[model samples]
Target chain A: MISRRIGAAAAVTALLFASACGGGYDAAGSANATTKVSVTTFGCEIWNTWAISKGVYVKHRLDVELVRSGGGSAAVAAVLSGAADFGYVNGYTAINAYNTGFPIQMVSGANVNALPPAKPAQGVFVGKDSPITSPADLAGKKIAVNEINGINQIVTASWLKANGVEPESVSFVALPFAEQIPAVLSGRVDAAQLGYSLLGNNNDGVRSLADPFASSNKVYIATYVAAKSFVAKGDAAKRFHEAMTETAQQLNDPANKDESFRLLSECQKVPAETLAAQPQNAIEAAVDLAALDRMAQQMVDLKMMQKKPDLEPFVTDFARS
Target chain B: MSDHGAKRSSLAASAQAMGRGVQSLWLLAALLVVWEIAARLAGSLFVPPVSQIFVAFVDTWLSGSPSSLFLSDQFRVDVLPSLARLGLGYGAAAAIGISAGILIGVWRPAGAFFNPLIRLGMSVPVTALLPIAIVLFGITSGMNVFLIALGCLWPILINTYDGVRGLDRTVVTAARSMRLTRRRYFLQVLLPGASPAIFVGMRISIGIALVLMVISELYAATAGLGFYIVSQQRLFRFPELWAAIVLLALLGILFNAIFAVVERVLLRWHRNVRPEGAEGH
Candidate 1:
């Protein structure tokens, strides 16, 4: 009798637990029953922060879940897998995905080119007292980059090539971003490639070498992309795009710039003043087909992409004013 | 047996062993050759050949500056932070998992209460919890440790529970007959018997802990192996990415070997009971 009672209780407990966890999706769906949009970490922390803070979803009776991914590549993968409705990817990653057969299209622009000319997110740095000034001087010097395949290295490679330096002329080392400044300060590396903010604060003994973006004549980087299937399936994607465009306008407004910077700082855990001082590297919210095509061409030239994709057909016209 | 028959049997056995060994070696050699050729054919972007990767690896690890390809202190700066996190997170998981597992196994009410929770936890993907963990702990070592623990806890807890519950009833009865208290019974009878299961759990959790450690680092980590790999991939440095992956695989093998040695040392008595050829050592 005791065994029977224990068995019955266990069964009941298991059933209850199963129902509770499974019911979570049902409840979430019913609550909004409206559009559900998925975004990545970069979008969540920066682009989506403005919308989330203003209760935009609540106002529209929509649901927006920020899905964190490894990076732009991972975000694209999520959308392709049907795990996310939308993803924010850099132009390079989006083009790479499209070439690889993922039917994704850029819907709207989140931010315009915020990076300074010749400098993308990363810039080569040398100790303020170091004699390594020109790319030629780096021939026998050690250079540090965040990763071998990161924007820092890509810009560094392009910078070296443009300066008539061989790709292997200087030794390249991979180090973490946080450690790059210290490494350069300690004279561990002759030069290091780092983000603007790291060099801005004088956190370590480093100064920017050359801005790669300045040489490239390219300004806009990163964009928000959505799967073609989602864009076609429902009006939910269109609504999400509208909300994003509205949020971008708010971020662009001069009156809200301070608040926008603060939110960005809070989300990124950086000092608001530091972020505000750096050149705004964000693009205005609008998909520029030509800019995207240029990015794709650059990727092809750099051998990151196998072929240049026709991006005009890939961009969704949901935001056509 | 006749001398001829014995000789034939010995020859067959030797041939079988030799065949297996040679096959394994050939498989390994083929994989390396294929990888090298494919990387070379893929050119600089999709894949960087093993030679280029080796050059990059040596350059990154040894050279302090652009010109020289020699070892430097800079490598430690990138490698140590990740190792430190792994150590702390894995250690915490091991301690908590064993303690909780034992408690639940020994106490009926505790087991009933925790069983459902553990099942739910194990089923929920660890990546899904990252956003919440980040919000609560922020982007620090604490967040990585929490995620690692979440991934490692289930296997350890479940294994420990099974280990304790499966303890020999005869041993418990004997301990009780001698008027052994609950504490004494657990330490003297239950723990020793449950050691094998606990070890199994630990082994499973260790692998999971490593994966979680990397995953957490890959996302928001300011430092670590996963951060190293992601940063490299982002920069489109295929060679450096490959090197980091190789290093991670080596680390995983090293951890597993260490755990196996520890398991063998602790469970020496069980060696006699284990069937022939079944003992890992």
Candidate 2:
């Protein structure tokens, strides 16, 4: 009985091994040759939309694999861990990672242009009916921001400082974008700093107290980054950059604005009408090297990063071509 | 019993009790001292001191708006949603697990048919199924619950099978000789014998359920404790993230303690029934 059981178990194990080997070989031939890039779910809209809308990169003989992650920081970690060949991260995250000794290079710029300019993606919002009207009123009041070292917090802090509000004068709270509206409506917080994608024109219950992008006009929002090790010497890396640059150009074309919005809406699972109506004024697709440098400097000023890291070493000049 | 025997037995029992008390107190003191030293050394980013975490906990509990405790509203939105999902998902897992476990344990044919599938299911990590779950359920509470249930179901089922299969053969034979009805056989023999294993399964499942709960929340949740931690970590609110971790750990310890208490109470009769000098008893 024991021998028979052992034989059965062996058969099961062998079957599993055989199937896995077969699958791996099939997948390797078709998918493994292409470099896989993991973009955060929040940033998926831009990358996926650009990939499908701009047929330039697809025409360049490059196969792109996109993986959805949670946030910019997570995308960097994914690349560092070898889970992804490239990652889509925010300027703040890229600066932080570079300062912390993570060998990463920004290949192309993803959201450098903030167009509508009136309201940026990151903004501090107060309830429409709230008594607190200005940054000074936020003193001793709870203000919701997404994360401590995030671009929103840095911008908010600088704005507060510029307005003569002490950093410690007001309490900062953290909440997700979707919850920010309800949190403010429910009076859980006096104000919330939310992403432009979420707090834009549609939200009626809150008023923009400050716009981060407008406050720091030169700050780059997010970027497409790759690990230095992967891009150091490989045709795969060059192909990736070529694809990314082409996609960026396509995303910026005025003629493709409607198509771009539709693709972004579909890929992000956001409502088409809502995305169409989203304020695209401040959204840019060019890789702004100067803006990136300023963002790095801001992180240094805030002490979130050790120093202002050299952007030249970390950014591949794909636009030069 | 002889007086001399009674005296010796009492002395041994008292010594053992004293030793247990001393050991427990020592353990508690060691843990506190270690926590204080570690908290002091690690600083705010890696580890918040226990004192500050305690204050954060109190603030979260007492504040009318828990979202006010952090720099973002994400924590406020995600915490309740995550907990609600956990409750629903865990409850479903428990119900299905116990019923299936009992059924398979009591019937040889049922156990034989389901054991292989149960083993296979347990080996596959639920995280790997995230994409499939998202595709099937979308990025909603349903996806979270499905993952949690899938993670928690196996341990309970396996424990139930082991509990029933290990029952004393003599007891089953005796019950059969007496011609006890199938219902009576289960109620009086199978279930009682399997109770200990069921509790074991429950204990294991609780932890697994919590992990699954966190993972599901972290990936796509708009709100929950997992989402709160991720968002905070992303934003570099290290103190808030640390506070959330502390709270989660406390919740886990609390859940385990509650389950243990329930087990002890339910198994009180079984405790005395064990043969004297038996290793387990």
Task: List, in the given order, the native-contact fraction of each candidate.
Answer: 0.17, 0.17
User: How accurate locally, in lDDT, is each candidate?
Assistant: 0.72, 0.71
Label model 1 with its docking quality class: incorrect
TM-score of chain A of 2: 0.80
DockQ of each model against the real complex? Answer: 0.09, 0.09
Candidate 1, B149-170: lDDT as tens digits: 8888888889989999998888
- Residue A40, candidate 2: alpha-carbon lDDT: 43
Interface RMSD of each: 8.3, 7.7
**RMSD in angstroms between candidate 2 and the native structure over all alpha carbons:** 13.5
- In model 2, what is the error at residue A64, expressed in angstroms? 1.6
lDDT of 1 by residue, A1-321 (tens): 999999999999999987765533332233344544666665334667778888775455456788877667777767767777677776666676676556788766665444453235546778888888888888867677754444455556667878888665665665556666666776756788765766645645566776665565553455677778777766666666677777777776789888988988888888888887776565456677776777677666667667787776787776533
Worst window of 10 by summed lDDT in candidate 1 chain A:
A23-32
